[model samples]
Target: MDMSVTFGDDSVAAAAAEAARKLAEEGVPRALADGDATLWGGEAESEAAIRLGWLSLPITSRELLPEIGKLVERVRAESLEHVVLAGMGGSSLAPEVICASADVPLTVLDTTDPGQVRRALADRLDRTVVVVSSKSGSTVETDSHRRIYEKAFRDAGIDPADRIVVVTDPGSPLEQSAIEAGYTVILADPNVGGRYSALTAFGLVPSALAGADVTRLLDDAAQAREQLGADDEPGLLLGTAIGSAAASGRDKLLLDDSLSDINGLPDWIEQLIAESTGKQGRGVLPVAGSEPNEAGDELVAGIDTEGDIEVHAPLGAQFLIWEYATAVAGRLLGINPFDQPNVAESKENTTRILGEAGDGPLPTGTPALVDGPVEVYGDLPPHAKDLSDVLTAVLQDIPDRGYLAILAYLDREAAFDVPVPPEASFETITDIWAAHDPASLQGLLAIRTDRPVTFGWGPRYLHSTGQYHKGGPQNGVFLQITGAVTDDLDVPGKPYTLGRLQLAQALGDLDALRQRGRPAVRLHLTDREAGVRHLLAAAREV
Candidate 1:
């Protein structure tokens, strides 16, 4: 692994070294290895469930190396052309990362957007194997994706059982469903939590299906495992840097990867560090996917692979390294890295709002479209004019040590009712929209404000950064942008439409933020594309 670190100040480095020594003396690493939850200031029984599962992933992955190889061989024998993983958060991120280097065509459906869902099912339903993955097997998004695809497969005169695979804990509802439906079922370890299951079946099976070199990946992970107990282990050193930096007033973590071939790795790390440690009024803010030159109270780390090695080696190494570093960071932050307590609030709220849905008009407000490109909605303070004015108003309330969080409830891609032409595949559409729109919004916000700007897509962020916004330090100024869902789809076993469900989640989170007394603004746009354009224009004006 070709990894290096540099601190903005010598004092920061000295403090990190001291902290690493103290942590070693206190046996933090050993406690983590032994599955002791004592380092976290909480009842042991309460935190015990999440501690041990991730601790053994590196070793377990190595043990399962042969099994992974056999599975890949079986997949090849079956002549499966594509694999679509229907999962969210932990269940999805690792597969997406591994598939970046995959030879087999793999698509991960983590969004409930009807258009994206349709695109995933448009052409590949025949020779494609759908992997329905959820640790608990009951995630709404995962189950919903499975239901939609199953219906599509059946309608197309295909036997869904022959083309479906289930990845979940034994006896999970999804596992039982898969068994009853005669689908291939691969039971993940029951103890491993979703976010920490990168090295477990949740990640490895997909890696194999994608035709990745699982043996080499496991070899790299095994190397990372060997460094866990050493005093100067790379994982520990990085963790110490993160822990000490946050403790010394540099809580904003700027993570960048120079490896162009690997995408979404930073997003995975963002969830791991943010959701795990962002609680009890202190957390580390991971800034990824965007570049901000101003490093005020921020720790910047660049992750690069050695030029001589294959991408999978260092990529696999990163999985173990970050997992261990985050555990160390959790110990230093006095929190349990395994459990996400606040993640359920938005879910429950969304369910309640859906249950209460009736003929009532959707909860939406008009934005004030003044000289700016986008309109402002919700409570826009007293004198805000356009979306930019609303952002400027929100900026005024940011504390000296605070950051800006741009939360978008807009669909990641435009919705389509008809099947896309074979000439223009899902990948083509993604490539078209890849460079424009919200991709530049982060840089624009960073250049406009001194405070660090973090961007998160809706409902998805509800599972990732939403935990931090509510449970972490109240040093965030939230600007939530929501737009009209023109083509809505129904979620199976739910009372509301997918569009309505998304709206409910957005409203639920916005309400939750306000209830916490955090400074937040909601902007409702009539047009999604225009809304983004106006948002960028507003950001530039600010």
Candidate 2:
């Protein structure tokens, strides 16, 4: 194996060891390797049976190397060097991590924000080759992206067939559509679920197209596959640690990637672990935030960052071990790890809202406090006068052992970052420099609370941690920040604009959470730039 695993605190080591012993006695590793369906019980057996195809991918995926190589060359030959991956969840996250770790640039469109979507369409359109990847073949965001891209290509007088590549299951709706449209389609392994498809065509197609050495990645994972399922191996040990930690009341897994050689790995791990095990009203919250909290209920884990356990590995092996570990953790938690049952509620809600909304402005709740560019839309304390008080009221609702999720439904990617808070005091230069990062919002607020705080971008996170928020433990308090879209873009073939779609998705998730009886508040930014600045300043006040 090309991975090295080192255990940190001995606090959960005993429980972890016991978990491993139980797994070994039950032959869990061997059973997983052999594609046993009953490992997660009868309820999950059907899903597990088909989902276990990922177990064979390190070996089977090698067959795709030549095809991927030939395709990459063909794209190059056609002068379409720019690669845009239109996907969500597993389809986009895995490749984003893979390409970033390999120091390659692959444009990923996993969002419905109009500004963000517009930016991708405007960048190098003539040289672009879009890889439309969707495990379900009917993901709304993916379908919308494909439609817009097709229109863009046609408008530029280019054949969509020459620039569009579809990666999906063999018999999926997307596969059929690609065939009918005369576009190239790459079939993914039918047995592998979306989250577990890092080694499948979904992860490779766009990555390889963007100039990553995917053949070498397969070689690395193949080497690790032979021994990972063993009882004493790194994969099993790591899974045992995770299961034991969560079961022992340390449910928040703070993923510290500050010192990692792999760029943007925590986000990928967040979805894999969160979606896989975050169900049955029990789950581990993967905190991919800027800093780990001082709360004792949190288990600080790391990629190359130091914590309760540190993992160091090649990108390919990292994917394999984490998948294996997540499965094992699911067993210890007594939940079916392969299924995301609550993920569809928001999607369904969005569809219904869009159907009934027509051209009307989406409804909004009565505002509790309206301060300049920011509007507080949810219930806050009676004494909450200013924006800072509203922010404090939202954070105050976080229970003793609960988490706070900051959901920003705006084009945060397109937003620029200003300097650090003037009143903040830092001992290290690194901390000062890190404040300028656009992904630093949750971090600044994270410093305000001793509890675990997580941040997710709009619509994109709907496919990620949105599952856990509704299905996992009911101890999370949500702070949903939505923006009034200043520059809106229309969907080429739909009645709704991208901004409208983004707001609807946010409302959908918020409604879903409220239906679950979770405490939440909505804060609308009438002016994004000023609203964000005010929010950050309010964070300091909080």
Give the best candidate by TM-score.
2
Regions of candidate 2 where Cα sits further than 4 Å from its true position: 416-438
TM-score of 1: 0.89
lDDT score for residue 83 of model 2: 95
> How does each model score on lDDT?
0.74, 0.86
Of the candidates shown, which would achieve the greatest lDDT relative to the real structure? 2
User: Tens digit of lDDT per residue, candidate 1, span 1-542?
Assistant: 55333455566668767988998898877666666766666653466555567666767757666766776677678777788888888888788887775544578787766656766777566777788888888888788888887888888898888788788988888888789999878877777777778888889887788777777777777777776777777777778888887887888887776664556688888888999888889999988866655555777766663211112327677887787788887777777777788888888877777666675766554544444335565556667755666677877778888988888776565533324556998787654454345656777767766778898877778778888999999898888877677777766665666677677888888878888888877776666766666676667888
Q: Where in model 1 is the C-alpha error above 4 Å?
A: 1-9, 42-46, 62-71, 101-104, 259-261, 305-313, 365-375, 413-436
In candidate 1, list every pair of residues with a backbone clash: 367-376, 368-376
- Kindly list the per-residue Cα lDDT of model 2 for residues 319-428, writing each as its tens digit: 88888889989988999999999999999999888888887878676788898888988778889999889778877888899989988887755543335566767644
